[model samples]
Target chain A: MSSFLVPFLFFSLLVSSVFSDQAAFSSHLLPRPLILEYPENSVETLQTQLRQFDADELTLQCTSWRVAGEANNLNPWKTIPDECLEYVRGYVNGKGYLVDLQRVADEAVAYAKGLQLQGDGKDVWVFDIDETLLSNLPYYKDHGYGAEVFNPVDFDMWVDKATAPALEASLKLYQQLLDMGFKIILLTGRSEAQRAVTEQNLRSAGFQSWDRLILRATEDHGKLAATYKSEKRDEMLEAGYRILGNSGDQWSDLLGWPMSTRSFKLPNPMYYIS
Target chain B: MSSFLVPFLFFSLLVSSVFSDQAAFSSHLLPRPLILEYPENSVETLQTQLRQFDADELTLQCTSWRVAGEANNLNPWKTIPDECLEYVRGYVNGKGYLVDLQRVADEAVAYAKGLQLQGDGKDVWVFDIDETLLSNLPYYKDHGYGAEVFNPVDFDMWVDKATAPALEASLKLYQQLLDMGFKIILLTGRSEAQRAVTEQNLRSAGFQSWDRLILRATEDHGKLAATYKSEKRDEMLEAGYRILGNSGDQWSDLLGWPMSTRSFKLPNPMYYIS
Candidate 1:
């Protein structure tokens, strides 16, 4: 071998050991190239990889934006930042997303298990629909994972198909709650007009049944999600259904007066609602 | 060379390329080996590495515990779970914490910049001291990043040192807010007796002055942070100050009635106040 090649080969020998170890040690939080989206060129790929490795300013900023929303520190946000599309894409499609989802589910179940139910059959678990029970990832998979401005018309078109799948972690939680004898209430911002398809989608997705699948009425239009959900929760209260727990992706679904006894907010780094 | 060595050598060639590109791409969120703690045995290291690699259940659960606290989903948590010591260590000592801190600071600044100031100088910004402005991380660093249950006597001894450093991002934000003509209020759960040391520490940490440093009086003892802070905020209003913005590391510091126009919560995965 050439003199220069000797040291180069020695260095190569060292790094291969590290690579061999990663396979055994890879955590789901680590990025996996599971998406079959057409690959970008080497330059773009290298730049993106380097950016993530360095934990660049913009990457942290984007993460902060998403996390801030989750923490309810940042409210009334519109779309994910234009620069953070790929970050959001990788996050939503990656194992990190599942880890977050499963984490909330585990905690929620633990919380449920600890409850000494009054057993009046009025104990209800409130869940938001989209991104809580059913996922619209099939639609979002094409829509830039919320980098694009939300198009309600296009989203409604996707909803019309009623093909969204259950969030696997949430599905398990839903079933577990049912077995625990808590009544289920699906309080969603989805319009009442979508009730037929939404119900069809819910049943097909293994949700089985809910005592009440509350959706927005015509009068509920133009109200903020927080305001609308608050009113619905009030009605649930008046109906003698004790809201023992509430689960949703948006803080709006979790907050407001007459809140749940415990609220489990699952991860949704994609988008925000008021 | 032996035939077996030939394939192994070729594999090494491919792996080294991945490591070289990592330096450029390192983000603040990536784990960094900054702490000088001695390394564990290879077997233990490998076991941990493997667990994190699969995004194993326990790792995700611990992350959930921490994230749930940030989301206010988990309340009144006691300490970092025994199973998640290393995860908490890695996160607190790693780049992720700084990324979280800097992100909050940046967003807080953005929000501050947009305010149409009344120019009354009575518009005050309320700040939680520990973990919000001054970082007690040096203490927590030795305390297993909260794996150990909190020891008030030990913690108080550390606080009495009056040597805690300013969170760099918060320090910058403080300077900028002062420059922008906003009155500063330092509200903390620290006691009235510790005022001397607290003020000294604040000055030493680049916090020059505050319109008010509202620490707990003897009568304020036994009240929860939310209650105490709320009452104090009411006092601020009574004293003719407009709380334009509030920032903290705990929800207790942000919640309660008479909230600020905007509340900025910095990240604190190590502990939860309420």
Candidate 2:
């Protein structure tokens, strides 16, 4: 090589080494999982249980819970009498809880409006499934019944069999938003594996008129276990919904919007932080 | 098999088929690349020529340019010239033009305050690399780069040689934020391949005081790119950033905040989108 070429080559090698090292470190810190396990229990059951317990008590108990471990103290295997589970489920699944429902609905409505087309004048709303539009109360309630630890396989099975009755007030509000020419987008954390059952449940519950139904990408295992809501939110933002408002029971769903933008939170007191 | 087993088998087969179809469809639709490309020459001398244009005009033109393939009636390739290339390089490498430096510094200060131990009050700011804390203008401008096409080899070479002077203002802002008990965070989008160079570049730029320098995970092909930001944002939020403001050039970076947050956008008039 020429004398000048030697220096160039050396610099190139240095740069290449630097590039490789940075890439390696990043991967080390942000390792992507090959499979994402969706905990079987629904947010609804957790919400109901939270209602049953005092907030201060739960917070204290949670403080003792180790956030990272093979054991999840959040869902202890303690059997609740079937009668009690059924009663709580009924109250949670039924209507007349409009105050909380309206708060969430109002948020969703506001999000939908914010996403309304700028000059097109068309309105649209995108909703996420797991902890957003519907509650997974039955699955978790079953967990309480059997007093079992959270399991992905069992959760998938439950989702297939699960009947999602809308958080009544949310349904009415969503319908109202749809009626006003706002396009309804049903985005969910449910994997492509549960797409059919999920869509079936939505249709059965009268959520069939949505403009689009997006299920989580199966290949996105790295994100499945965490941050799924944000990924879906990006898709919604990309689709240009002037999101006037968004409603979800999870903090992740509402964090992406501009300040004072409408985001309604339903009570999901059962479990905190996915 | 027994009669009961036969019915169970049939049901499983039915369910499996339904799931398979949905998975196939979703995989086909949702995994598209988010960035687009401009003509090879479009970005050629942009930095140099851009010096004559006001920041607002530069930003408007940058965002308004059609992707290479979608340029409607305009020919981006026809605009390049050798003389203007250095000028473009100057702007791409100069630190004098960023308008959001102070804003980023202010936001970082609030974030640090939130994360401090009651009286510790040390400040820190975490920033994403691509389109966030640094401008990749020269790399693309040198190659007249376009988004639809990703040339990893050439891209890597450019990144290796890339110097980020525009970021000086942002870095200075980071320093100010740090002076108020805040630390700096150098988050990036470059995969594992660019790790060493990224770190060296940061260090070279006098950004040795960062709290963390997180990088993108490479194992899952960045399927969770959107989620990565949210997860990090949540961590910051949990850390108690009082007025934790995030700065990024992409919408994905700002997706999940609950408050009316502040964010500063450094112009990337070249070509990028989440």
State the TM-score of candidate 2 restricted to chain B.
Answer: 0.54
Best by TM-score: 1
| lDDT tens digits by residue: candidate 2, A29-60 | 22332112112333343343234233222321
Please give the RMSD of candidate 1 to the true structure. 10.7
Which residues of candidate 1, in runs, are more than 4 Å off? A1-65, A237-241, B1-65, B234-241
Instruction: List, for all models, the DockQ compared with the true complex.
Output: 0.19, 0.02
Residue-by-residue lDDT tens digits, candidate 2, B1-274: 1111222323333333334443333333324421122223434323322332233233222212211111111112333234333333433343312322333444445444555333344233456676555656666755653332446687778678647534665666666666665545555667766778887776676766677777766653554444676666666567765434455654445444332144443433344434
Number of the top lDDT candidate: 1
Model 1's DockQ score: 0.19
Tens-place lDDT digits, model 1, residues B62-164: 6556667788777577787787776676666666677778877887888899988888888899999999999998999888888888988999999999999
lDDT values for all models:
0.77, 0.47
